[model samples]
Target: MKRLIARALRRLGWLRYDLLISPVAQHPGKNAVPPGELWLVIDTGVKKWACMSCPGGCGVQIALSLNPDRRPRWSVETDFWGRPTVSPSIHQHRACSCHFWVKKGVIEWCR
Candidate 1:
């Protein structure tokens, strides 16, 4: 059911993933982030970090820092409909090595 909806959204030029914002200091728990979704944990009322599963089907969770004081951090922008666009690009340096861009709910893969 969820997978079908995600695929339909992707086919419609929307992102297969959605953003789930949580105003908490710690990750809610395991399974808090669904597949094809990004969880933004806002700490101190500021965007502190973002987490999402590897889109490459590796089943690994990627954590990106949103803190401006940190180097190599990324920022997220939300559209009027609440879709998220992550600036620059995300490149995993570890296993999978998946690199891609999340723009307006679509994942554009890189070579």
Candidate 2:
């Protein structure tokens, strides 16, 4: 099955996610984010938001607030290799309800 193959590829470290930084303050359009890429929005040197397409294969875009002053905000840290680690798991309350954590560019799906 495709899911099994994907898991195998992940285990073999062939599959990994990437982070892309954008200085534009506006929200990314539906097709702006490519698969396996997370976009970080920065405005005037302030971290604004993180955007990415849903990993659940539903093609929905998810945006999380990066401002520490806002409630339910998430923080992102990157290693020397530019691999990102996001604190606190991301849980989609609607849609496919996919929940996961991004650590070092790897998605750890939550059950």
Candidate 3:
């Protein structure tokens, strides 16, 4: 019964972005990344990476770098409540081809 209810909720766009700060180096696959939640990994007070599952429901984990020194890196900004807002946009050139922006805990899909 609970499983069915959870599925229904997920289908109803229950996705919301949440923040998580981790110390050790880790990959998104090494963690349980639910839908609609973006994991922002911070190492030594510096935001290093952001990751989340594909909002397209393809189950693909998208990992983005936050290092400014690195080319093609995304930046994460957190509001007073700790909600995350990502800059530019995420373009998945892979099979899923999912492109979207996470602004203030909302996913904005690009046309």
Candidate 4:
């Protein structure tokens, strides 16, 4: 289900793969985070990577793309801010960002 939603984000123009990076080299200040693709995802950078931003440690999230191993990972930044974090909760069910773009329009999940 997660992978499906993630893919749908790509289908629309909302979400995009923005970078080819290694945290080790890209962010050498912190722990020697094992080499992996580091994305400069728009709000994702602040929302999920607040630890990487200021010393605030505000927005933080786990990478939805891990294999349940020691290998750290990047975050999944689906554009769903300012508008609707998700569609109006309906009949107890929830509509995620995927559904939003699928219904409304692209949020330009930038980098």
Best by lDDT: 2
For residues 1-111, could you state the per-residue lDDT of candidate 1 as single tens digits?
Answer: 554665577679765454433334665355545665677777777887777887887777888888889898999886644456888799987778999998866678998
- C-alpha TM-scores of all predictions: 0.73, 0.75, 0.73, 0.18
Clashing pairs in 2: none
TM-score, candidate 2, is: 0.75
- Looking at model 2, residue 57 earns an lDDT score of 80
Ranking by lDDT: 2, 1, 3, 4
Superior by lDDT: candidate 2 or candidate 4: 2
What lDDT is obtained when candidate 1 is compared to the true structure? 0.72
lDDT of 3 by residue, 12-108 (tens): 8673443322223555666667765677777777878888877787777788998999989999886644557888899987778998888866778
What is the number of backbone collisions in each predicted candidate, taken in the order shown?
1, 0, 0, 0
* lDDT to native, each model: 0.72, 0.75, 0.71, 0.27
TM-score between candidate 1 and the true structure: 0.73
Question: lDDT tens string, model 4, 1-111?
Answer: 544564566679655532222222122344322221232223323322311111112222212222224334333333432111212211111222221111122222312
User: Could you tell me the C-alpha RMSD of candidate 4 in Å?
Assistant: 14.3
Question: By TM-score, who's the top model here?
Answer: 2
lDDT of 2 at 23: 36
lDDT of 1 at 16: 45
Residue 29 in candidate 2, Cα distance off native in Å? 4.6
